[model samples]
Target: MFDNVGYRPGRKPQNATQEAIFAFHVALRTGMRSGEVLQLGARTLDVGRRVAVVEHKTQRYTGKPRRVPLLSPAVRLLKPFAVQERIFTIDDADRDALFRKVRDRLMLKHLDFHDSRATALTHMSRKVPVQVLSRISGHKDIRILVNRYYRESAEDIAKRFA
Candidate 1:
């Protein structure tokens, strides 16, 4: 679990870790899957247009391209780390290792790599409609977004009813 696994605490990441953190933050803020974020290339980001084209891992449903509007936070985090060829590139094993390291460092429990996408979707859904959120997240089916990504709490329900 994340809270129990203490790899590093209150310490900044070194060279590679910093880049990994930047990539993770971009995925977190932009509602992008880890694979999508990792697949990003320099040509994928159009800063003048403020849009990023992400190629989904599973192209069976959503096709090849999904445009994501870059938030200022995501842009700022990624700008310095961007490379000429790829924004972020790590093999599946390395990606998982990096996520584990980040989870341990942050003292987060039960957080998996895919959880970042869910977290981003949940956060975005609070401010946007399910349809809009689905579009932004490149989910063709709203059911996937609602059933899997959005986590509603008892406190929220009670507040709504109150």
Candidate 2:
């Protein structure tokens, strides 16, 4: 499905399709929501520190800022546009439309951009503790992290134990 975007990793995004793909990559890598990923700017992202501290969904309830650790892949994706006020020029509507087009072409029933958060956190659960994953994901409740986001199949878990 992403093949239609014609985006090769490490290449600068040249068009809207490529930009949307890159934005998806950033969200996948950072575990950031689509809005947070789109809102990212040089002011919020610290490539040098490999972290992005921003006001996010749980900040209001938690009374703490969300600190998103930028993995190497995310750092590479953002480095090019780090100087810009907005990392991704793509807006919500454009992104939604672009993703909808891809979803339709690929015949995917549920391919929303917001799914990146669950996908990212699921992947992170394998390597990080639940507490750490919650921090990365800005989930105040560990139950939400384990029950909602960390979706590993029983077979997959059994294989790890085996």
Candidate 3:
């Protein structure tokens, strides 16, 4: 279900650098905020476990770190670049620029970097139960999740009524 064109054994974009595409794909797959994705050091990834230990940006709210599982596409994209000390070395400003530039060039309407995280949570909400998604998304409380994240979609309600 993941549209992993750039991340999975595909050619790099002509105008964009590999790093640019990589940052965006990682954001998409990991559900990491652009800032946290920028801060990721290579060591945070556990290849054996297929999880990334996020330096949770919302740690002050959640008071715990989060471990996000990586599917094969993400892991494949990571393996080659795994040697870099800082998984992503680009600064916040440049990171945003690259993501925006690619989004525009591809004509992906109304897309922004932060949408990647929201997209991830929305998709996962269907597959992962709220309790598990709370941990994955680092939501401080279930109410915060149901009240804010993925509020538009209620799969169970649809199924029940139908």
Candidate 4:
């Protein structure tokens, strides 16, 4: 949806649509859930270290903080918002409503807001080992990572062999 009509990448957001687009880009880059991205605050980001330590959904179960490695691309996108208390001002309900309208307009009704995490992990899986990906995703079970989020197509897999 970032490529859709309203999104303007690389520029500071000027309006609500641009802000939502920016949030989605953060989620895509950091492999963070929509709520996590919306809740992201300046305090959570460690730009010097290129990582963001976030309190995630699984934090209560594992009793460990989630450390999300921020690649250069993600850092660039996040730099402008580093001084703000909250990166994206929209709440989950608003974010959901925005995404719903975008998806409906874009004919992407099948897309879910949470799909960004899965998509990010799938792309990251190609560059990092499963163990590393597991760490980034905060998934204690490798099986969950493999079974649920690592969604490389069979055609893509065959291309690797070829």
Off by over 4 Å in 4: 2-5
**Cα RMSD to native, each candidate?**
4.4, 1.9, 4.1, 1.8
Scored against the true structure, residue 41 in model 2 reaches a CA lDDT of 89
> What does the lDDT come to for candidate 1?
0.69
- Give the TM-score (vs. native) of candidate 4: 0.89
| Angstrom error at residue 147, model 1 | 0.8
Stretches of candidate 1 off by over 4 Å are 1-14, 60-63, 81-83, 105-109, 157-162
Task: Give the whole-model CA lDDT for all candidates, comma-separated.
Answer: 0.69, 0.81, 0.68, 0.80
Q: Show model 2 residue runs off by greater than 4 Å.
A: 62-64
> Which residue pairs of candidate 2 clash?
none
Q: What count of clashes does model 4 give? A: 0
The Cα error of candidate 4 at residue 6, in Å, is 3.4
Ranked by lDDT, top first: 2, 4, 1, 3
Cα lDDT, model 4, residue 118: 93
Q: Write the per-residue lDDT of candidate 2 for residues 1-162, one digit (tens) a residue.
A: 457877777666778877777787788888898778878888888899998877777667879777888878788878877777876788878987887787777787677787888898888888888898988888778997888778899998898889
Q: What is the lDDT of residue 10 in candidate 4?
A: 68
Query: What are the per-residue Cα lDDT tens digits for candidate 4 across 92-143?
Result: 7887887778878989889887788899999999899999998888788999
Predicted candidate 3 versus true structure: per-residue lDDT over 97-136, tens digit per residue:
8767667777885987777777777777877788988877
Q: lDDT: which candidate is best?
A: 2
